[model samples]
Target: MTLTEKQERALCVLDDLIDEGIDVTNLRQEIHLSNTYSYDAVRTRLRRAFGSVENALRAYGLYDQTAEPERLELERCFYIDQDYRVSENRYKSEELKELYGISEIKFQQYKKVLLENLEREALDIYVRDTFPYGLKRDYIYKHKLWHVEKYLRNFYGHSVRKLCEEWDFSYELFNDSYSSFYITQGHIFEGLVGEVLDAIYPGRVESQRRIENCIPDFIVNGRHWIDAKLSEKTAFNRASKTFSKYLKHTENLTIIYAQKSDGVYSFPNVTLVHISRYIPELIKIHRSDLIEKINAFLSNLKINIENVS
Candidate 1:
């Protein structure tokens, strides 16, 4: 029951607020700013503070019971952050003047669009932080393993030479050929799978090391062996037969085909999956239960509030 990063951050903010004598239950009405700032800046500061508290409350399910007037005011204040600000060019555009002509309708439309974008951006950030399975892509969202070596370097905090030393290896191998690229691609795909699995089912994914003989890419829950195939042609390759033999004794095994191709293929008596399909499915499931998950996350934080009233 690990607290999500958002919950941890929100808890810290709540602790600060409570330490400052701000009432958590009546956050919007009770928060008070110092007289040091100008009137406008003070108002802005108060709004920003209230917005943060409102976010924390919402994360904890406390804000769901907020009064209508307070909730609406908090929502308005929440949008004042720099991320919600329109670009200067957009502000000066002729379309802006036309939009302003129909102020009431345009305001509602603009708010909707802005809030939707903000929510999407926040979700994306959270997903990345929660499951940093690295995949490079072009303008379109396609899994490209171009950043494989880079990710490995960063994740392991070592270069190839350093890795060899850390692992107590005597020799090192290097080649810029397709074979080397293929190996790196395989590692990247397996890493992505491991990250996603770990996010959904934390502390269950364990990557197979280079020295591990006859091991699959990952072992989930110490039972299911997950093999990542980055190349479509690998299915037909003789090496795949050897891989199959390694996992033959295992009761449950899954093959993750992580190539960029579109079509699907089935394997004999084996679970076959494509990365493109796999990632989106996991994202959909996560999004479907996101609110309940966040609430669970808050409960895990164990924030002791002595003075909510």
Candidate 2:
């Protein structure tokens, strides 16, 4: 696509900002503050020209493979923020997919790359901040070593013991600050589930009900415990352990999962329900407008569970 005159101007401003090491996360704001262009006018023109601000950045070489980690993170965060803005009813799922060039697998791969880069950056910062005098083997302690071991095994396919020998960083002090840095899909899904429950049951729904060491996502009618999970059935074993604790407090437990499954899962005192199924059914009966929000949230996750029966 040929760049419009406004887009060309915007790109020039962006280039100057990048050269000056100014933050471009708020691209519209920066553009407006830098020039006579109205903020909304620039945003609208850019969207009309490039579909999204992120796409414009990509076309302008800001998302190049050799881009600095800071630049990449800023670009990705802007992309994600734009996605959330549109997903909250500015556009439908199909429109979002078309505009963002997103598919389920592709989005997942993009997130994996983003997360890996963030983890590497976090690790570097942690080491630099904690060990200003350089790391020594004798100064390390092995507290919660298994947690770091499992994290490395899952995310990096590296063995922690070998990694410690190779990298000279304490497993105990290497905090995975990803959760602290970003709002994860799990947290968003749980919040969506709470919204749906509140819309349907109103005054009868209680959120994050604590029962001893366990806290289910919600309790409906003060009897039925509900948990919202973002994973597919592969999380059954882990969820089962938590559900077992929930069942002791309630007669039945319900799990509202985001991903689709092949068959209905069976568990003692538990019912497995896909969010697609549960939300649509309630919307059919209650006629709640929150269905659109739920659909949009699922679309952002690139999870097409809308067709599940």
Candidate 3:
């Protein structure tokens, strides 16, 4: 895909910032401040075009770097100070202060430095165990590692891009996985919808039956088209336009959304329904065992699907 001129400019700015050793966790604000684009605009454009700001930086051959000595220092400090093993002891800050015979202010400063190194050490161990050869940025986000990302940024002042660089990983090889993750997730949700539909309309549900240029997710009773979306309706306008082509084949089109929206989405010959609401109701009566499967799927996605009533 070719990037627009503005997107190209944003990538250039991001390239310069990474070279200057800027922390990119707050990349949207950084890019917005560096250019005429608003924060939301920059964020939306980058995400729409590059999947993420990190991926945009990767597109420009930019990745974060940390000095080898700094990592070694963190590891040394963590190992040398046995008391820094706060996770095992579960000591309160006050208890630690008293044990060390220090004022609260001094204890706070001491704890800050200790935890910084400790977090880095823990993160390193986690990366080594979980990703052996290299950490995949898309895997982190897909698995909902927000806490890990936040901890690394807040305590270690490092981003996933930095870890990738440190591990000698190539972003070019895995950056595309960011977009593919969403596509995979969407396909999973679509399959879940198809299963639910199969239980409801048994033997009447057809999968990905093509009609002209459009291939809807499912066709029920050889008439209605069912399309499962794993995102909010506000983000479905592009898909909706494409689905409009299916109207020529079938007047009935059901758009099932995995995520709930506050307002109803409207389109010609299309009926919008949330998966959480519609699927559970059908599954409760048609196939209760599917509840376990649905919940397991949601748990893996780190999301909640309402129980069947």
Candidate 4:
């Protein structure tokens, strides 16, 4: 299909940004409207320009900028781009009247759209026609995915923010209309990890409850615990450190770093499960070893927890 002139321009700029690894938002700011793009206009132009705004950005080709510097910029662009933030929440419908205040419902609605858009972007690569929204991948590893392991539901920023509050995390919520924006489907990542853990242990795990000192990801069999980290090396290191710190005080704790890293990396005791290799590889595993490995994982994790406690 041919693109409109404006969309062609948008595509040109998009390809340039993707190739340059330049911030699409920054590029959009500098090239599209000369610092005049409002959130709504930007949203409109982005939707008009690309079939999948997130996918186009993921096609961002070569980021030749300074490695670390460019990465930070990518984070700002990929996660913070105003273009990807364009979707509206479905919960905006009036049915939420008695369930929450207008303000609260609006927050959840926005959260839903943001997560949906992000997932749409990430899931765009897996299948041509059957990208399931919030659908759990029954098997573990996904060789096709770029960043996530599975899709999850029933989570949003409000939940994470609530947990942050419980942990005294001091993370601040940005006013939608005012803040520059940091776009991460963090809630979805948390939710999916919680869901997968539940599947793995079946009835042994439940979504985590927010409590200052409580684990923020999952409660397995009402005892085992997980702190989910989106699959990135830095995220792994950070989560590993957090787990290390956690070991100084808690018992029966396990930090699960779900990543596309090395195809679903599961560090035996550390529990770093590579989502890429996880399910496929596990499917081929000898049932005995798989169970034994899972048991060993819990055991070593318990050892880590003992140290933390």
lDDT per residue, candidate 3, 100-208, as tens digits?
Answer: 3433333334446667646555554455335422244565578666556665577436556655565543344344555345456767988898888888788999886
Instruction: Give the alpha carbon lDDT tens digit for every residue of 81-158 in model 4.
Output: 222222332443233322322332233334444565455443322211122221223322343332334332222332
Which has the greatest TM-score? 2
> What is the TM-score ranking, best to worst?
2, 3, 1, 4
Comparison by lDDT, 3 against 4, better one: 3
Error of 2 at 286 (Å): 5.7
Residue 188's C-alpha lDDT in candidate 2?
A: 82
Candidate 3: where is the Cα deviation over 4 Å?
1-174, 261-264, 279-286, 302-309
List the pairs of residues colliding in candidate 2: none
* Tens digit per residue, CA lDDT, model 1, 77-133: 232222222222333333432433422222343445555434433332222222222
Kindly report which residue stretches of model 2 are placed more than 4 angstroms away from their true locations once superposed. 1-183, 234-237, 261-265, 280-288, 303-309
lDDT of 4 at 74: 19
Superposed model 4: Cα runs more than 4 Å off: 1-184, 210-212, 234-241, 249-253, 257-269, 277-309
> How many steric overlaps does candidate 3 have?
0
> lDDT per model, in order?
0.45, 0.55, 0.57, 0.41
